[model samples]
Target: MRIATIGTGSIVDEFLQAVEQVETAECIAMYSRKLETAKELAEKYKIKSIYTSLDEMYQNPDIECIYIASPNSLHFDHAFQALSSGKHVICEKPFTSTVEEAEKLIALAKEKKLFLFDAISNIHLPNFKLIKENLALLGPIRFVQCNYSQYSRKYNQLLNGETPNVFNPAFSGGALLDINIYNLHFVTRLFGSPDDISYTANKHPNGIDTSGVLVMKYPNFISECVGSKDTQGMNFVLIQGENGYLHVKDGANGCRSVFIHTNDQEVNLNAQTSMNRLFYELAEFEGIVQREDYSSCYKLLEHTLEVVRETVKARTDAKIVFAADKR
Candidate 1:
């Protein structure tokens, strides 16, 4: 698939690198609010077209799809524009600021007969697939704990009365949307939606959640997802069960190493070899688009919508309100 990219952030760099690994996908055009930013990335990736205008990019007949890595606030607009212009979209995580936005985008994609994907890396990773396949080995699950906490460089700025987009409510940026969303996708993709969800958050003066703990209650077990930008911790995912337990050493974002432990046996299952986690999702998107597999794409879109619903509930319950929430 011939693709265009919407942002020039660090994540876009990672996506560009992953594109190199996916033989079926190539980024041909880049868009940025600033021409210099677009040119810099275009030059690095050897992309021929640099678009400073979204309208211009949409007008380009050569661009078949768009990979949106824009800020949280812009996802809906960017994805909508791409889809409305008859282009498939591979959107970054936290698909939209609200479930309504996600639903509209999904509907538009269907209306246009185009592919819409939530670019969640873990769901497509080999190790993640292994975890799902081996879940039976763990027997009946009792509890799940996922911790993905890192001290954000911008967190210090927030302390000194500076608001980065990552910590700003108006931009729909916070711990739950930024870091914890990964944990949500990982769990929901594997086990489906939870029976009940609740969130308690540590908020900045700006009313944004700097850190939070989300609890998802299932019929069988309770899952705790802890995500923090205000503090740091050892990042990992632990699943305890009746027979054995499964552990992911790295975190929900990247399943670097997976280990299964039972009473009598211990095994290390590391199926992911690629350094770039984004490669898997991009490759999967390429396959879906190439084969016109809308059935599979919509199934994943349904999963994304479920995640968005729970996310809205979590944020609302915690009184973490984004500007989009009012809309």
Candidate 2:
């Protein structure tokens, strides 16, 4: 997959690095509002093309896919344009600001027969798959607690009255979408959508969540997902069951390590090959796109849609509205 990227953020840098590890994937072009910003990243990665206009980048026949790492609000616009331009898209997570936008993008992808992926890295990790495979050992899950909290360097900027894209409601930036979404994906991907959902958050003056706890109730289990950008803590996931439990180190984002405790014995496991969590996801995208596997692509799309639905519902329940919601 010859990928072009449409952002100059740190995530874009990570995505480019991950592309290097995937043999089938290469980032050939980059688009940013400013050429200078994109130039730094392009030079670092040895990318030959950089464009300040989306039209120019999208017209390049050499660009087979567009990796979007824009702000949450722009995800829909960027992905929609890429898909309309006949390019496959890998949009960064918190896929879009609203369920309607996600649906529209999915519909367009299907209609155009193009691959559309939400750039969710965790669920595609080898260790994450290993955790899923061993979930049966836990025996009848009862409860799940996932916490992913890292004090954002941008949070200080927000505190100083600078609205960083992440802490700004207009940009669809908040703890839920920005930091804690990994927990949502980890629990939902393993157990499916919850029976009920509710969210409570520590809100800033601009009505964005600085930190929040989302509670999801299932038929037999209850899961609490805590995501915070205003604070830091030990990030981990604990899945308790009738017979035993599984402890996931480094929260849902990395799936760095797993420890299983059973009646007979206890075991620790880590199956990830690359330290860059984004590597696994980009590699998977490369294979799927190479094989033109729409069935597999849409399966992941369905999962992403369900997560977006839950996210929208959670936001509605908490009355945390974004600019996209108004639109």
Candidate 3:
């Protein structure tokens, strides 16, 4: 699939670097608000086309898909533009800044019969899929606790009066949207959307959450999510059941290995770090486009939108509003 990337950010750089490994996908075009930025990305990545305006890329007949790695507040706009242009979209996580925006994108994609995917790449990993298939081994699952915290360098900048994009409310920057979204994904992927959810966050003076603990309640068990941007925390996910426990020591976005500990035995998948499973997500997008399977992509996007929908609801119910929020 020939994809046009819509942001010239760090995530965009990483994606472009990784696309070299996924032979089925190519970065054919790039678009940004600045012509120099777009041209730099095009020249650096050896892409054929670059557009300073979003309208130009949307009008480009050669671009079939758009990958949006822009800030949270812009995700909906970019995805909507691509879908309106008769193109599929793969958007970065926290699907949109709000559930209503997510719903609008979902409805529009359906009306246009296009694919809309969220780039929560780890959900499609082989190890995660395998764990799902063998969930019975955990007996009756009781509790799940996940922690995904990384001290952002940008957070430090915000502390010293420099407004980095990560800490700026206008960019939809906050601990919850940054990393807690992954924790929500882990919970929702295993147990579906929660019966109820709440977030207790450490708020910054600028009205954005710096660090937080999110709670997703199930009828039978409790799932806890810890997400932060102020300070580093031990990143791990644990699933405890009647038998024993399952520990995933790695972070949420890239879980390389997992350990299963029962009363009598211990097992490890021995998943090496070398294999860049992110390639699988890109390949799946290409596969869907080649097969013209918007329905399949829609199913995934529905799950994605559900998670973000709950997150937005949780934030709203908590009365936590970012300055960037639209009334």
- lDDT of each residue in 43-111, candidate 1, tens digit only: 888999888889999989989999999989999999999999999899998799998899899999999
- Score each candidate by Cα lDDT: 0.93, 0.93, 0.82
Clashing pairs in 2: none
Residue range with the least summed lDDT across 10 consecutive positions in model 3: 269-278
The true-versus-predicted C-alpha distance at residue 253 of model 3, in Å, is 1.5
Answer with 1 or 2, whichever has the higher lDDT: 2
**Tens digit of per-residue lDDT, candidate 2, span 203-272:** 9989999999999999999999999999999999999999999999889999999999998688999988
In candidate 1, clashing pairs total 0
Expressed as tens digits, the lDDT of each residue in 138-255 for candidate 3 is 8998899999989898887888888876776777878888888888887798789889888888887777788888998899889999998888888988988898888877756676
Per-candidate TM-score against the hidden true structure: 0.98, 0.99, 0.94
For model 2 the TM-score comes to 0.99
Off by over 4 Å in 2: none
Instruction: Give lDDT: candidate 2, residue 27.
Output: 90
Those runs of model 1 whose alpha carbons end farther than 4 Å from true positions after fitting are: none
lDDT for position 254 in model 3: 72
